[model samples]
Target chain A: MNVLRAIYNFIFELGDTALLFLKALYWSFRPPYRWRELFKQMEKFGVSSVSVVFITSLFTGMVLALETYTGLKKFNAESVIGSIVAVSMFRELGPVLTALVVTGRAGSAMAAELGTMRVTEQIDAMYTMAVDPIHYLVVPRLITGVTMLPVLTVISDLLGVIGGYFVSIVLLKINSHTYIRQMLNHTDLHDLYSGLVKAAVFGLLISLICCYKGLSTKGGAEGVGRSTTQAVVISSVVVLVADYFLTAFMF
Target chain B: MVEETVIQVINLYKSFGKQQVLKGVSFSVKKGELFYIIGKSGEGKSVLLKHIVGLITPDKGKVLIEGMDIHQATGVDALKLRRKIGMVFQYGALFDSMTVYENIAFPLREHFSLSEKEIAEIVKEKLALVELEGIERKMPSELSGGMRKRVALARALALNPGILLYDEPTTGLDPLLTEEIDNLIKDTRDKTGVTSVVVSHDIWSVIKFADRVAYLANGRIEFIGTPEEMLETDNQMLKRFICARLEDKLMTSLFNACRSRGSCTS
Candidate 1:
């Protein structure tokens, strides 16, 4: 019986998420564009997050270079470290890791803010005012997430490659020209595009899940806390799981 | 003027999980009436208000607002019906991110195409209506409790909605502030002639200002009548509820009086 209930709940949540996504999409095309809200959300989720994404991606690239150099040196292939790091960052690490960081940062913040609004009856106030909460709240965030994650992922990819180049040349004693050439030859614009597509998908999932959690929050402050945590946890897991399929489909 | 029923709930039923909140609840509010639904916490008074506002769909019932069955209405129809009603939530529910001016101007901006100057004029008018002036730039968090509720009231009245819903409007307020809100609600109804539906446990407020009162208990409305009728009721459950609240109010008043005289000990 408990297992049955679990399955039912999972299906219910899946249907709910799908419905919310469709509603958000419908409202995004509708009039009353809410440009102010969209720009605010873009700044919040994308531009404000540049420093954290930069640091994380840079270190991730540096660490990847370090790890790959030791392994490739066994086969006299240490020269390929830059290529491996660049390809990994472009196709996999950049989008997935940036999304993970954002899920923790902006996603949780979205959930918490909306959850507070839910608990405080601000969302209900919107409903009473003849404003659809989906149009007013979710659409802006959804647009931001879908648009900004790619921009952040681009930054991440660039920073990651730069970090990898620095490590390859300065730390690993590889020539800077060799490192740059190898990275350029091995990675393509398609790799960057694929990562960006993945980022957009991840962004959609994160914003939708977080906003849904927020809007549906019950109980009160404790409920807000629960929703925020669930938004981060579920979106993080979804990002990683989606990354695998995206990588396979794209590459 | 001929009386008209502006809001009606018929045999409303709602359940969350295993707990049923509203069971066969039915009531009607006449146009320009100050109707109050009084019950203890968790008795689903707010739930019923939500139904009337088209915020919640009942499992089995009809909520008609201005003669349109709200639940059965389509997208545009629902929005059109909802626009005629304004709701002030318990904690004010002002948008925390926006300034007080922006909060009052939000519904106006959303439902109409108005220049910022026009919106500002309306916002100023609403602020003046609420007797709050010249604090438009402050966030909701900056306002006192009474100020927040008044701002919420201004926002609710911005579109000049035909019906107004107040959910526990005096819940956290002190006695003086509670009276102030109660009087504000009465003044709003008096001045605008808008139908008012208030969900609260404030027996004194209902006794003083309500044109009609409904007592909700045991997942249903146990009594519905004028406050005089409620005061003279033979229904034991409702009498107990009213007496209990009255007794509390009396004690608080007595305590305050004694404290003022410097002759009381708890």
Candidate 2:
């Protein structure tokens, strides 16, 4: 019964959150907007997150290449390494890995930031100023996340492919031409399009979970910590679950 | 001198689960009045202020600000009504990431259609009012406790709010800083004509700054009178709360802290 109640409350919360996002979107285009805040959030969410994303993507690509080459060589399919890496990176790994990294880096920080504000009444202060907290804090983050995640995924995919290329050509002695040809042959616009869509969704999910958890935080420092942890956990789980359904439906 | 009632609370009741923090709490603040909610610490002073600002809704009863029923007000109306009230939190509640200038300028930027130059001018004026003109570039963490409160005050005044609600404005300050804050509050009230409702246990503040003092006890207003009247009251709770004896202070602090912390934990 407790589990059932939890699930019920979760669904209700999710519905309310979706409504909030819609309201945030409505306010995004409304006047008295804070363009400066939006730009600042973009920089914080997108620009500062690049180093971690880049490092994680590079290593993920290299590892995928190594693992795939080891198994594919047994089937005499080593020539298809680039195609496998490119397709997998575009279709699944790029968006998923970038999102997971961001959930740790940006999502936790966002939760902590807003959670502190919530407890300390800075968010309330915003409301008292005739400014909606959703419009000021959540909307800019939503916009940044929705717009930047796909771009970040594309960058991650490119870097991952480069890492895979290096591993294939340098370590595996696979011809670059064959690798490139196979990659181009197997992957299509549909694969890239699906990945970008997933990236956007993942971005929205991360921002929503983080912002919701932050705003709901009560108590003081301990509450902020709990919200941060919950934001990361919930976002990561949601990203993985959504990825499964999206992939199943798309395929 | 004639006085207008800026805030009138009628039978306000608020509870967290089974623990009732405020039970039929009622009070009023006259226009431009320096009012203080004096209690032994957890007598629902902060909770009462939160209700006034519509941060928390009362379980029963009404909170009328100027004339609008806040708990029943629509979101649009509530937002409009909130614009007339400003709050300074105990911890200053400054945005950690933003500089002092950005924090103070937040309300102006959010509410008005002012140009950058106009906003800058207002920001400068507020900073100057708080005597923090040159430290606009400093973050909240860099500022001392007293400075943070001043910045918070400047932010609260950014919209030129008619009503100012301060929650424990001198909680963690040293003696000198507490007096400094008291003076600042008086100065702000004088200059802005903002109806000030201060929630604090600082007896000196109650004695010096408050035109009227309301002592909260047992989730209700135990006493409401002028500072002189409050000091002269024979009510044991009011007397003990005002005397600041170590045992009375500890018990009050512990009770209030436990109540707020307990509610938060649950």
Candidate 3:
């Protein structure tokens, strides 16, 4: 019975989330466009997140290069370490790690802020004032998430490749010429495009889930805390799960 | 002249899971009347007010604002109807992200194409009406509880709404602040002639300003009448409710007097 109840709740909430997505789309295209709020959210989720995404992606690439060198040297494939790091960074680590970092940072903040507004009746106040909360609140964040994630992923991919180069030549004593030639010959622009596509999808999912958790929040401070935690947990898990399918289809 | 009803609830029934909050509750507010819904906390006074604004839909009835059923109103119709009603929440509910100036200007900006100068003029006028001028740049967090309520009132009045709903406007205020808010509500109604509905358990506020009072208990309105009529009622439940308040007030006054004399005892 408990398992059945859990499944039932899962399907119900999934349907609710889909409905919220449709409503967000519906409101987004209509005007009295909140350009100010959209720009504000873009700066928050995109610009403010640059430092963390940079650090995370750069270190991830360096670690990947180190591990790949140790493994490939046994098989005499050490010259291809640059290609491995580049492909991995562009196809998976860059987007996924960037998304995960952002989920923890901006996504949780979105949930907490919206959840606070919900508990304090600020959302209700907006609704009563003849402004649709979906338009005034959800749409701006949705646009920011969809647009900013891919931009962040591009930065992440670039820094990641640079980090891998530093690790390969400076640390692993690999030839710089061979590293660049092999990496360029092995990877294509398609790899970067697919990764950016994944980033955009991740952005949408994270913002939608966080915004939904927030707007549905009840019970005041405790409820806001719960929603923020759930937003991070659910969006982080969704990013990983979606990454698998995206990689399978793209590759 | 007979006052027309601006707000009405007919046979409203709402339940949350197993807890039935409103069971067939019904009432109407006449034009320009200062109506109060008085009940204990958690008795669904706020819930009933939310119905009027269409924030919470009823499981079984109709809430009509100016004869248009709010639940049935859709899209632009719903927005138009909502513009006619303004609600001041218990905690002020000012947008924490915006300053008092932006908060007051929000509704005007959304509904009209008024220029910055016009919006500023109206915002100042509303602030002055609430007796809170020249604090527009202050954030909601910067204001005291009473000041927050005043700013909320200023924002609610920005559009010159036809009907105003206040959910426990004086709930967390001190005695002097409570009187100030009550007076503000009274003054607002007198000046604007906007039909007002206030949901509160503050018996003193009800007595001080309510032109009519509805006592909500046991998921229904047990009494609906003037403050004088409510005080002189024979209904046992109402008498108990009023007597409990009177007794509490009496005890508070006695304790205060003792403390003032430095003869207070537990």
Query: Of the candidates shown, which would achieve the greatest lDDT relative to the real structure?
Result: 3
| CAPRI quality of model 3 | high
Q: Is the docking of candidate 2 incorrect, acceptable, medium or high quality?
A: medium
Model 2 C-alpha lDDT per residue in residues A1-99, reported as the tens digit of each score: 999999999999899888878888888888666688888988888887889889988988899899998899899999988988898899999999999
> Distance from true position, residue B229, model 2, in Å?
2.3
Query: Where does candidate 2 stray beyond 4 Å?
Result: A1-16, B244-266
Go through the candidates in order and give each one's DockQ: 0.82, 0.56, 0.81
lDDT of 1 by residue, B201-247 (tens): 97777766788999999889999998768867888988788777457
Q: Candidate 3 regions off by >4 Å? A: B245-266
Worst 10 residues of 3 chain A by lDDT: A242-251
> Could you estimate the TM-score for every candidate?
0.94, 0.90, 0.95
Model 2 lDDT per residue over B71-114, tens place: 88886797889889999988888888889988987777666778
Best of the two (1, 3) by DockQ: 1
* Every candidate's lDDT: 0.89, 0.87, 0.92
Candidate 2 matches the true fold with a TM-score of 0.90
Tens-digit lDDT track of model 1 for A86-195:
88998889999999999988999999999999999999999989999999999999989999999999999989888988888888899887777887899888888888
lDDT of 3 by residue, B201-259 (tens): 87767766678999999899999998768877788887777667557467446534643
